[model samples]
Target: MFFTNPLDNKLRKWGKAKQELPASVSAMKEKVLASVKPKAEPLPKTKNRTPYWFVLSGALAALVLFIGQYTLRQINTPVADSGFGIASQEQMALSSKYEEENLASDMVTPNVTPSDLGIQYGEATGLGGRSYEDSMVEKVSNFISTGQDRNGAISDAREFLKYDYSATIKTRKVEQISSRVQTIVRGHGGRVDNMYVQEKHGYVYFVVPKSSLEAFKNEIKGLVNVRFYTESVRAQNLLPEKVIIEKSTETAKESLASLEGELAILTKEHNTRISDLQKQLNGVVASINRLRNEVTTSTVRQEEIKRDISRLSAVQQKLQRQITDENQNYNSQKFYLDDRIKNAKSEISNLAEQDQNLQDNVETVQGSVEVEWVSIFEIIKLYVPYYWAWVLSFCAIALAVNYFSKRRTIEAL
Candidate 1:
């Protein structure tokens, strides 16, 4: 009863081992502390040393640049808003004045020399000479070669000098006048721009160079009856407009070049996209072809079905017509049979009534006949004695006569 358990003895040994472990841990911590060394402190950072003047100078320069750019933009804004960029208000006013002066001067004819008109002519320049065309060509060449200022001066000088004349020639001989005018225009080194002819009138529009205009008018004056005549001079200042057009043309050329570059890039991208799209399109086309084939087969089948339906419909219609006809025939036969049966029934009823009446008449006739037969027998009995009496009287008379005859015969004998 006093024996100790084995588990209790083991628990006591475990408690003793745990009590010895703390002394071993303290000795290990003392050895680690004896081996360790102390660490040094980190160094401090230095402050920035740049001068304030450098930053101030940089800010001032940026401010000055921004102000200059803003001022420049403010100055250019109004000029840009005006459509004519380089032309000033003074220049525009001068051009308008020149236009007005030219318009006024165009109404009156002015004495003009070949040099004043900016044309060059030789001594042999005439309506009948080939040098006239040469002189016109020279004038055009000189006008082109001269600068804008000189051209403007020349244009002002020629403003009232250039003449355009139109005349209505009322002549019955239109063909002859037309031929003569054409010859005159050609002889003056001019060309016919337009010509129209009618039965009663003819019209001719021709252009003669400034050098030949007077000669052309002189030649055509007396050829036909001049009904209506008009002369107009072209007097316009084109220098300012020409400068603007030239500038605009230059800008347009630059823009066109830039646009062409962009277009080239776009075209390249478009070609790439198109190639990809073309591959997709090829697939789509293959699909479409397959669909088309399916559609064609389906269409064929649909057509066959439609034909079948149409045939069935036609057969159905024919059967319906046949049924209708049969119904009509059956109805007709039924009506006829019904009418016959009704008539037979009616005749049978009438015959039965007639038979009943005949039976009644026979019975009445039999009764009357029996009564008449008894009456007739009674009458015959009453008549029979008279008939016998008459017969006996005649027999007696015949006996007397036979006796007399016998007596007479005996006497004779």
Candidate 2:
């Protein structure tokens, strides 16, 4: 092999008989290798080696975060497809149902109402009794409140005292009795509730409220003959007990309806458990029916059970008498037949003894048969169900009442 290196020629000239390379020469070879070695191809473009798993992981993380946010949003706000909020829906429904109803008062408010308490008090003074004029005219004016009403209020006062009045011992009608009667009543702040003519042709009866009653009677006194007639005056105050249970029950019903509506939406959209929803609907319907039955007014039923019982007893007595009569007749006939049979048996025995040859034909048969008489017990047994309808009706009413009371309590909550 021919070598092209001039270094080898120089090495041959200096070499005495082919000396082997020393350790230093090996070091020099290593240095030459270090210098001549080609550099590696820059780690095979490692920056571009982004792991497929890393990208996938990043996308997955972002998707998970997005889903989490969506879930949170759905929970916080129930945005319907129509975009109207629940409050708006409630308002619209209220308007449609009640026709621009006044808004319900908030729970936070104190007691407020339209009614005011009325009172009347007075002191008696001077004579044995106050003048009839003062009691009828002045008292009414003081008692009635003019501030409560804006419409022209009445002021009951006697404008005229002297007026025509006639008294008749005999029954008669005077064409013209008094002119001041109408004027006096009109002057006093009073209105007539009702006027009645007494059995006596000349007597008149008037009934009115507290402030108006006195004036009304006084006016009548002025109109007719002033005779000493029984004038009775009495006052009555009615006490009212108010129950708000109905309103409470109504509110609960509305809440239940709202819950039902939400449940319906869930069923329509998400296909939620239909069985559970149907069960709830059944419960609600049952509650409604129960309440309705409870609220139904019951009418008193009148029956003549006593009369029916009395009639039945009479029939039973008649049947007993007939049975007794039949028994007595049967006993009498049985006793007569028994006597006849005894006589015939004796006659047959005598015949047997007297005529031995004819004894074979002398046999006697004597017996009595009884036909049972029909009884009334069977008839009453047949009618037992018909009469028990009243009892059944009572039980039904009781059940309805119980159902209603329980349902009302539930609804009120």
Candidate 3:
């Protein structure tokens, strides 16, 4: 290698000197090339097994890649609701509950009730109460942080909103971070609604008091490295729904009150009618007693009085039957009306409960957190400039390729 130095040729060319080698050096070069070109004792012919070797190597590489990919997928897949790092009861229940509730809230059902009565609220409508006014207010709010005073402009003071926060963090301690998040949430007067954890990743959903949302956010920010943190906030205005709910509640209450009033009036009328019938019955009894008490000297007159008494007794029996029938009918009607009143009261109660839930949503904020395990290499990458890393990697690969090519060339010679 020292005999054929590349730098010697370049230096000779630059100095404008002769480039040809001496006769002795040329002869030596020829001898070396000739010796390497021929093998001793005429080597036996070998079969061309290179293709088979290449095929085998390719198959092995493919199998290795496939197994690696499958193992990675298995590692990344989330476990069941009751699996590691999960709040079993809370997570399972909330997962199904919130998914259904969200779907229901997104659907819009037309006002099936009479338009004159306004929009209907309850499970019948799937809980959608987004109106044109609501849309306008939402759009306007998106442009302005606060509202302005005007004759008919809506006020933000009573605007109800449901807050949702989401964040993704990369850290080595996924389970530890998940547990810490749960603790922090609880400490902030919140509860974890759902969670899932794996060796390398985790997820958690929680709700905290809106009054403590800022504090909760700051604490969460400190849990993991801020450089690997990604987050977003979303809010849904529920003022229009609240208005509709209030109206529905009021309507239900009025209906209940009306039914109660009708019940009272029916009771009073029923009593009055029964009282009148009883008085008439008493009068009939008095006449029969008086007729019986009277002294009759003639036999014909006594017989006539007895006949009149018998007729009055028959009339009294008919009146008693009429009173009995009237009482039975009154009881049936009162029962039917009372049932209706009961139903109305139940509907009102349900609406009131829904309203209270809405209030609670406004008082609290929902949050979702995702944690991922970041390896040491990834941590180093965060501080290293991306372009510089790529350049260095390319240089290393080029050097390896050049080294392999030179080795193969020398063996061929």
Q: TM-score of each candidate?
A: 0.22, 0.16, 0.56
Which pairs clash inside model 2?
Answer: 155-189, 156-188, 156-189, 157-187, 157-188, 166-225
Cα lDDT tens digits for candidate 1, 262-286: 5466556556655664565455445
Question: Better model by TM-score, 2 or 3?
Answer: 3
The candidate that achieves the highest lDDT relative to the unseen native structure: 3
Best by TM-score: 3
Task: Single out the weakest 10-residue window by summed lDDT for candidate 3.
Answer: 143-152
The TM-score of predicted model 3 comes to 0.56
**Candidate 3 residue lDDT tens string, 73-107:** 54433333223322223443444455545644443
Cand. 1 TM to true fold: 0.22
Candidate 1 vs candidate 3: the lDDT winner is 3
Residues 74-162, candidate 2, lDDT per residue (tens digit)? 44342221333122234333333332122112111213231221112233323322675454334344434332222111352212111
Among residues 3 or more apart in sequence or in different chains, the pairs in candidate 3 whose N, CA or C atoms overlap within 3 Å are: none
Q: Please rank every candidate by TM-score, starting with the best.
A: 3, 1, 2
Model 3 bad stretches (over 4 Å): 1-157, 375-413
Ranking by lDDT: 3, 1, 2
Instruction: Give model 2 RMSD, 1 decimal.
Output: 58.5
